[model samples]
Target: MPATIRDVAKAAGVTIGTVSRALNNYSDVNCHTRERILRVAQELGYRPNQMARSLSSKHSKNIALVLSGFLEDTMLNDFETMLMKGIYQFAFEHGIDIAMYVINSRTQKEKSYEQLCYEHNIAGAILFGLKTNDPYCEALAASHRPCVTIDTEVRGPCISNVTLDDVTAFDELTQYLIDRGHRKIVLVHGRKNAMVSMERLVGAYQAFTRNGLTLTHDSIIYTNFLREEAVAGVGAYFRTHTPDSATAFLCMSDMLAIGTIEALKSLGYRVPDDYSVVGYDGLEVANYTDPKITTVDQNIKEKGYEAAHLLYDMLNGIRPAQKLVLPHTLVERESVKNLNELSN
Candidate 1:
């Protein structure tokens, strides 16, 4: 049989209320007593019944994670998947439960932030893929629930965010390509409203200006980050223009990069030999391509883990720093060749 709280209290020579306080991390209990109870509970393998505790405490001890796009959508990239894994792992460690709400046209309207909080008795929420003018963010802020956003920003008193430095990372990546003697680069980006896309575009432009290269409007392509969209976009471009028009292609995500490669092959154009490709989000898929894609490694899994812990801290009444920006690295691979070498 599993050990009970009462059993733990008796073993530790503490009152039932004291045991509860210690286990729940309530500050009312003395430090020495809390430590003693915790040690005793561990020795006896005492595990609190989470459901029962929630019922008694009137706090669900559960967090709601609202994903802004469908699982089948192109937005569900490696960054999203790894980030969710990190949230789950952190929540589990802290004895909290997570409920996921996948956002789509139907669910987005059906579920309101107020209704979700009231229905689930949620202690907090984590939002991924927030738009600059999203109504949900406004609602969440008004609800006054402790919330955290990953890869997006939200404005609220109790909300915090975790993200990468998109402009700097992208600028560095594009500059790397420029240094390799690649000119006439094509940029394939996501939705214009996405914060990341905007920041990346800024970085891309900075790279062009610094290198004294001209960035034409026609050189940029906007896609929904879908593999199909990437293929169709590149295919159409190649048909209307010449393969030699651009020496390298820059993709905002690995999924797009992979699609670009597929389309290039189908069109009988060789990667690196004919066109070099660079991708963001160094997903494992990047390495599997025929000529592996060069990309920026954003340490996605760690980002998730950190986001989870940050939210956990907020829930526990510990206000952590507002913005947590993780580091990024550029992974050099086969997809991009030094045009200088070709010139020489």
Candidate 2:
């Protein structure tokens, strides 16, 4: 067992309060006595209780990364793993403790966001996977706790959001397809309530409008951001609609885009030959695909670093900005074919 302040006090022939004052650099203790106490502490291998010390100073010295709405494989996904690496590195370098929590429907029912933070002694939090309409998001916005969210923007004095500029990302993606002479495009989207899905949809619409093209209501399909659902949605869409109806598909996520590719192959359709496919969220898994995926790289690690720093700043009463839009790039690969060549 390591030594405590009481043990150090006894060895140094001083009161526990005196030893604590010396350790805390209170200046009231004599220099000689303070030095003797520190020497005894060092000899006894006494390590201060960081948690208790933080409590005394009114700072928890701890932050939480909240992952909400995931039903399975909490940390196995490439995006979540990369984001967590950034947050973990930042916390380690800054000497702050970090706790990870996965919130699902059952957990949400058991504890509110504030309750979870309080129980964990978290000074601030970085929240992800929350839809804009989630009850926890609303509660977080109403509370004064320092919080930074990804993708969803919650309105509050202490709440900040970090996300890719979806409008610009998707606008560029759709324009890329348009520039290839693709006038017929299919849009595969995620959850309807998610803020990101809506933003990307807007960007897609803007691109089509920019090229003097109008998308009918049938051009859009929502898959709720699930792989199985995306496969089924694509299958169902093509059940009635011909493959020739759309020459390209703009998927809101790599997972969905990958599923679409698999579904097309299963139905004997070749990507970029029969139809081109584009995806968002430049997941590492995208590179392992047969033809590699063309998607928007959000630089998820940098976003995670920025989100953690944003919360850290907010905890210190420094409001950098209510919303931080990280830059993203379009990674072009073999998935997109030049429709102009086909026309020629």
Show pairs that collide, candidate 1. none
lDDT of 1 by residue, 30-88 (tens): 86687578668756756567634555453446678888865658454666777788888
lDDT of 2 at 50: 75
Model 2 lowest lDDT segment of ten? 51-60
